[model samples]
Target: MNGERTIYSILHILNGKKSSQTIQDIHIFQLTSLYQSFPMLSREQLEEVIQTLYKEKWLVQSLDNHYFINDTRKGELENLLKDNPLPNYLNGWKFHAITEPFWQRLSLFIQVASHLSGNSIRYIPVQRNPVTQLWLKETLHSIAIDRSNINKYLYKDLVKCLEEIEINPAILINRLTGLKKIGLTSDQAALEMKMDPSLYQLSFLAILHFMIERILSNKEDYSLLCYMIEDNKKNYTLTASTAKTYDLIQKGHNIEEIVHLRNLKQSTIEDHIIEVLLNVPAFPVHSLVSEEKMTRIKDSIEQSSSKSLKVIKQQLPDVSYFEIRVVMARYGDS
Candidate 1:
């Protein structure tokens, strides 16, 4: 943060607030994976947690009311994580929007398939999304699986895909609803597995995202799982505003043109383009900042310890802040 940002910035970052500053922070701080990692976190809950850290003297409040880690206690956070490693499959920025839809489709599909296999097809739906329900109803007739033996096929596909991953199956399995059974909620599953609810939620999301990546990689092999996302390229990768910007960019609009067409501030368009650079591979950010200037920005960032754009802007006097930001998003560490 370089201690230039306020505490609420962290709060907004964790909760995945879609503002330009919040999105820029995700890249500037090298925290892209942790974007939208805690969508369930509340303002009050985060304040309380921050208070605890303050009380423990692990985080100190600056004169400007920004939070910075106490240098002496900074190592403590890393040390604690050493004993309990983070899950390997979390790509929240890439998969956050699709996780819930994917889970809803998969869970509801399995739940319905289970009942059908057992000759009890009138069970309540575990997923209540009307869209997902509609998709399932339409998809049932289309899947190649025999209705009478869907459980066997789904189980086989699920087990085969899960076998390649490292998370305990129960983290996902215990959350499934089948026949006359109701699945455990996140808190319930966490208690049963003796894990913190936060960790359990994160782990659950990680496994789902892992499955998504695997399915996208080999859809022909994972047919049943593949059905869950058969039509799922529904723009979960970009924020709504960014998606609009992406469309305009695809039509060959420059940043100024996008701002004029969308009636948004120039800064807002720049933020969307940064998001494009981060999410859309090979979206041609090189033209936004020429190779020569991008090299200068990258060099400034590499030589400078500060993540402050203001500091870097001082060094590269010719670079626009938008140019510096795009360069940072493209070339920043992590």
Candidate 2:
């Protein structure tokens, strides 16, 4: 849909409002300002465009003298006006338009597939729009049927990110889904689930429980991260100022005591310290602490009290909680 002549003027007015408007209550103020800006427009021409937009359902005026940009038309206008070398201006409508049959076909395919997961409707109020809900549901169901396609679409950087993180994809996949019961070793299952034989390099990221693992794995794969670690370590080694800062922090220095530490601001120092803690691999997921049965995992690891893998494994054998200490050890934290 083409933007009405007053589009820029209305956008400027809306931008001035600190808060967004309720759709029904925005018309006269915006329109009046737009008219004032374009004094050359005859009253008839001004009225004609507004009335025409309203008639076309692109501009909706409610019972309360309020106006709203129609959802579909607004999306079309935004796409057309988007900042790009090839803005969706010429024959873009043909490329951009969506239809029921297209979505239906995709949905049918997703449903018949077994390996795919994580398919669902996002951002739309499916409950209120029955027709749209059915269309979306069917599309998602079809996408799920073709597991590889769904995984590819959903996880665009899956393989590359996984390898970058230094995680054996086979191990991670096996961990995600317990395959031992199905007579499949985690290693075997992970290998089977590996995405795209061609582009197999996974980012250190994109793993479920290994946000920190990604950082550590990347440090090993790329030397830049190693340099960062070494540089930070050198500061601790050579700089008396750095040593004093650590001492102060260890001695419980408050913000006021730590503000004068060189060019680094107090906030920056605090952030650096927190970043260190953020990547601790003590447990792959932090939520383990809140689970009633799992609080002991931390206490057990911290004290270095000897506990067999068999004993600890019994508490939460299949869950990642049991593997937290292992992850921590891998990162040299243990």
Candidate 3:
């Protein structure tokens, strides 16, 4: 229904005619006129399309002022022919028939089509038309950079693009806003626009560029930014390390006294003395200092560390060497 399709259909009907296909032979004037009867193109517009085809080398003009298909140009057009998605009547021109300028025109067509259809334009495949593909890719890359909350990696990628292009921040911001106007997140917009994600991975590199630029702009601000980045990294690492130290404390280490005696933070000495009490159990002071005579003898050197205890009168009960050791550990620390 568009002019491009109209031109293709007219050419198809006139194919293989040795003699020039005049307005009379093919009745093109009547065809254009009849089509124009119902809001068809004006006379001037119809002539302009014919002239454009000639300029593209599609139409050859004979000395007699009659027009025919140029064989070479026809070959180019034939290469672009594809099976129609719809009926032949509705089928139109092949997208690749036109030059890059034409592809640019088609992008505009897509924009208008989307507006008229009242739907957001999501994806536009330009694989077959490399020119349009490149344009769409650039458009997508530009869109993903407006918000700070946009994926961190994606933001970095876009910055890399700006760096490669040598675009100023002000210009970059404007391009980002252009993407926002079309309802796209920077990352989504770039993908939808068919830009290579990896190509933008230079975002990290762009950050370095920004730092360098800032340094040149004003040294003090650059220093502060560097310090802030470092401080945040250190703070996060320290917080995680502190959490691990608390886990050691809860596992029953006498870490506090050890750290205090060494004039260090408890965290710094946890790994060194973790096994200090591995084979020992805690004992109360009262158990070793009992006033009973049997208990007193247990604490004496003759009874202490003795492998076997003497069995005397029934009143002087024997105590195990293990008990003496425990008493010594708990209360005999002289």
Candidate 4:
């Protein structure tokens, strides 16, 4: 809460809202790494947390009614963060879509393999997704493993990856179900590791995100691990609606034409354009915005500290909000 955005905007960003404003906020605030990191964070949960902060005197309201970190408590919070910082691998904007599927697939596969190796077929599945189960069935046939060697192959690949990545494997290993063991739930694992429950869950996700990026990068080194996540391809950053808009845009349809053809509003199509530009950097910004307009917006951004659209708009009254958004989406990071 830097007073640039309301609490609702922060909530939306954590919830991974697909709104144009939220998407732009991720770039403008340099919070793309935290984008969609907490899909389970409900509005009520955020409000409760805010209330607790207020009660603890860690957050305070200004005369303008804007919420901000209390100057007196900020140092303590910063010190705590410095002592036990957030995990390294948390590119939620990029990996949020795939992390769950990757975890489900790996968890289910491990559970099934553990049962098979133990000569016991009575245990319940760790992952109950039908799609994940179907994928497991298909993958079992496709991979180079059978009942006799399931544990050996799984162990070798698992150890190889953990050793190479050099993360504390307990966060990952504790969540995995195996032959004589039922996997620990996130909270249970957290307690076992003497960590805060929230941190444990985030660490679990960070490891999964980290593993996904690593496996995809060096498929030759982690053949078995790579096979498990073959479905997690690179093209997953855009929303479904945005993907449709992206396809049509690539086909060379103008905004108005796309609006008429897709029956979407003009604003919605423009939002999709911003999303496209942010994710696909090679798309030409000049096609949608003039060089002069882009220059003005960049200048306004240089003077804008809060990254508030209203503040930026007030300074450049003639520029349409959409035009300013176009430049911010294109070169805000640059």
Best by lDDT: 1
With a 3 Å backbone cut-off (N, CA, C), the pairs that clash in candidate 3 are 36-40, 144-186, 156-203
Q: In candidate 1, which residue ranges exceed 4 Å CA deviation? A: 1-4, 63-65, 230-264
Candidate 4, number of clashes:
0
Decreasing lDDT order of the candidates:
1, 4, 2, 3
Per-residue lDDT tens digits for candidate 2, residues 1-334, read 1132244344333222211121101221222111112223454664576679889988876533346678779777687547322211111111112212222222232232213354432322312345545654554554323544554442333344445544445533333321111223333553566633211212111232242223334655432112211122211111234445556665766546677644567654543333222223241233322444345555444454323334455555554432443322232123
By TM-score, the candidates rank as 4, 1, 3, 2
For all predictions, the C-alpha RMSD in Å is: 2.4, 26.6, 37.3, 2.3
Candidate 1 per-residue C-alpha lDDT over 245-293 given as tens digits, one digit per residue, 9 for 90 to 100: 9999899998889899999998788878887777666777777878899
Q: lDDT of candidate 3?
A: 0.35
lDDT of 4: 0.82
Q: After superposition, how far is residue 325 of candidate 4 from its true place, in Å?
A: 0.8
- Residue 240's C-alpha lDDT in candidate 2? 38
TM-score of each: 0.90, 0.17, 0.18, 0.91
lDDT of 3 by residue, 11-123 (tens): 43333111112111222122311211112234465568689988988887763334667878766666654421111111011111112233243333334333334444464
In model 2, state the lDDT of residue 119. 42
lDDT of each: 0.83, 0.36, 0.35, 0.82
lDDT of 4 by residue, 34-91 (tens): 8777888998999898889889999887634358898999899999999878888878
